[model samples]
Target chain A: MRVLGVDPGLTRCGVGVVEGVPGRPCTLVAYYVVYTDPADELPLRLLHLDTELTRLVAEHRPESVAVERVFSQHNVRTVMGTAQASAVAVLAGARAGLPVQTYTPSEVKAAITGSGQADKAQMMAMVTRLLRLAEPPRPADAADALALAICHIWRGGTRARIAAAADAVRQRTAASRTGARPGAPGRPGPKRQGGTR
Target chain B: MRVLGVDPGLTRCGVGVVEGVPGRPCTLVAYYVVYTDPADELPLRLLHLDTELTRLVAEHRPESVAVERVFSQHNVRTVMGTAQASAVAVLAGARAGLPVQTYTPSEVKAAITGSGQADKAQMMAMVTRLLRLAEPPRPADAADALALAICHIWRGGTRARIAAAADAVRQRTAASRTGARPGAPGRPGPKRQGGTR
Candidate 1:
């Protein structure tokens, strides 16, 4: 599955695209950091971010998108910008009919580095090793974006499997009640459920 | 000038449009509370807001837009939504090429009422009295939106006057230096220095 991950911010929004499934090495497709001028009016800055994100989505056409879920624990002024930028990213994915997911910083860290409390250096080291890059992605935001993409691929794969398993169980139960073969395909259920994280 | 004021929220976004100058009694053009299902995904909710605001701007063709500036001191979760929604509203106005301004809650209250510490009921009462509405706009959100519009008009008028005065002084200074008559409109300067609040 091709996935796009966004580490959203008004000043520096990082975007990374990766292709892979769960339990497999993910391939890095591309990475970018979108920048907006702080001196610009808020609306124009947001508009610029929106335009870039929409263009990126059009270019990459990822099957799904993942964004870092912003929390209010951060510096109040910065968090608002982060939330606004994330909104644009989420809207870009949803407008394109792609499933969009958001993971907390801790969740992304735990998924990439095996610990939610891992520091930035540790996470960067893991992201470098996992993606088999020549060097660590420069400008922390880029690495964070890649990490979010990796986390989503792994977690989304597990969620998909669990959903499929639950669907199988339900199908089997329904078949037994109808006195039909358990292996037989009765009807197709929802393809996927609960895309948000 | 026609102004659209937005009290942005994920579930209930209030929009109000009015037409008038700074000191004159404003005339209400229209008012609405755009609703999005709270159960909807965050991206979907933002998309709904963007779509509605875009349509409103297109239909009304307002000269400018005003949105309430979201602060972080409010309920954390609710504040995030407010920031996101305000971002969408700002984007809509910017995309339509309208000047967009944001005012803090206190600023709006102070502009509408005599004091910034005024409560909602007092602000609504002023809004009703100022607009000469038959009744106070329904829902606190609606009244708040109208207040924002009114605030923008009054404050924007003051800002414009200040800008014009500054421009006039600069022109007179330049005229004296260049041996040209003052107020001759020599080499027309840029109009409207700033659009943001």
Candidate 2:
């Protein structure tokens, strides 16, 4: 599956696309940083971000999008801007009819480097190694975005499969408790006639 | 000027429109709450909000839009959702080519009830009285949205005028420093050359 990962920011939003599945080597399709002037008004900055991201999504056509979730920082202003940038990324993904996922910084680190508390240098080394690039992506944000895409491909797909399996098990348990045959034609619970989730 | 105010939330987003100038009685053009199912996925909820807010802006065609600036809350999850919703609201305004402003909750409260620490009841009462509504708007969020619109109408315009006057003073100072005419054409620094901002 092709995944587009976004490391969202107001001044510089990092975007990277990777193509791969779990347990396989992923290829970096493209990477870029969208820049906006801080001197511009907030709405204008957001408009620029939205326009650039939508353009990138249309060009890349990724199956899924992964965005870095904004965590609380000591600077409320900074956090607010990050959150705004994240919203635009998520909205762009949704607008393109792609499933969007968010990974926290720790989650991305754990998935890419097998450690929740991995530092920036470690992350860059691991990302460089995994993508088989000659060197690390510059500007740190680009590496971080590429790492996020790799993490989603490596770990997010597996997590989703496990969660789906658990859900199926839960459904079976509920059906058994209610004395209904599994996959019955017309019991309650999601008719499954022609509805798409 | 007509203003559309938005009190953004994940579950129930409040939207209201008011018409008036500063130091004048404002009329509530409309007030409502947009609800999203908690069980729905995050992207779908945000999509709904974006669609609805965009529709509201198109139908109302307000001169400006006002959004509640989300402050840091004890609950990180709740604050993130609020911030996301605020982003969508602000984006809607920008997309519609309306100037968007944001005010803190305490600022709205202070503008409406004459105290930053006013209770909900006091805010509701003041909103009702100011808008000439026979009774308080239901669900509190609607009332808060109206109060936000009124606050922007009553304070934001004055604030803008003050800011513009300050800018003019700064420009005059700069011109004096460089020994140029105060309002000379093509003299750098916001030449008033059809730049809307």
Candidate 3:
């Protein structure tokens, strides 16, 4: 699956695209930052960010989008801007008819470095190693975006598998409750359906 | 001036439009709430808000837009959503080429009740009285939105006057520094431009 990850902010928003499935090496498509002037009014800044994000979604055409979930526990001054930026990103993806998911900072760190408490340097190193890039991505925000995309690619696959398994179990349980053989013609017992989730 | 006030939220967004000048009784153009199902995903909720806000701006054609500024000091669990909704509200106004201004809760209260610490009941009372409504607007959110609009109309007028005064002072200062009469020939001595703020 191709995923676009967004590390949202007002001054600088990071976006990265990657393609892969679980247990497979993801290929980097692109990474960039959207910058807004601090001196500008809030509405103008938000509008610019939204315009850029919408354009990027149209250009990249990622199957799904992942955004960094913002928390108020962070810097009180900057948390609101982060949340606003993430909202624009999610809206862009959803408006394009794509599924949007948000991952916490710790989740991204754990997915990239195998530890939720991993330091930035460790996460950067792993991202570089995984993408087979000759050098680390510049402007930590861009690296963070790439990490989020990779994490989503991996975790999304796992979630889909878990959901499919649950569905199968549910079907079997229903068949047993009905006291009919699975897919029986007389009872029209529940049958296994393909995963569409 | 026609002003649109937005009290943004993910579940219920309040909006109101008022028409009047500063120090005059403002006329209520309309007031309503846009609601999104809490069960809906974040992206969908935000998109719905953006759509409704955009449509409202187009329909009302307000000269300016006012939104309640979200603060992180509020309930931590809901602050992020509030910030996101406010962002969408601001974007809607800005996208339509309207000037968008944000007033804090205290600022709105003070403008309405002459006290920053005014309670909700007082605010609703003032809103009903100012608009000459038969009764208080239904849904506290709707009342809050109308209050915000009234505040903007009054405060915005004050702000414009202050800006104009400052501009005049600046022009005089420039004239003295240049050793030329204001608006004189050759020097162009900083003509007194009409307020466009």
The TM-score each candidate achieves on chain A is 0.87, 0.82, 0.87
Query: In candidate 3, what are the lDDT values of residues B60-93, reduced to their tens digit?
Result: 9999999999987888889899999999999999
| Alpha carbon lDDT at A92, candidate 2 | 96
Query: What ranges in model 2 sit over 4 Å off?
Result: A73-77, A156-197, B73-77, B156-197
Return the clash pairs for model 3, or none: none
**What is the lDDT of every predicted structure here?**
0.89, 0.87, 0.91
| TM-score against truth, every candidate | 0.87, 0.79, 0.87
For residues A64-106, what per-residue lDDT tens digits would candidate 3 score against the true structure? 9999999878998899999999999998898899999999999
TM-score of 2: 0.79
Candidates sorted on DockQ, descending: 3, 1, 2
Candidate 2: docking tier? acceptable
Tell me, by DockQ, which candidate is best.
3
Question: Between the candidate structures 2 and 3, which one is better when assessed by TM-score?
Answer: 3
DockQ of candidate 2, scored on C-alphas against the true complex (2 decimals): 0.49
Off by over 4 Å in 3: A163-186, A190-197, B162-197
Fraction of true interface contacts that also occur in model 2 = 0.68
* Alpha-carbon lDDT of model 2: 0.87
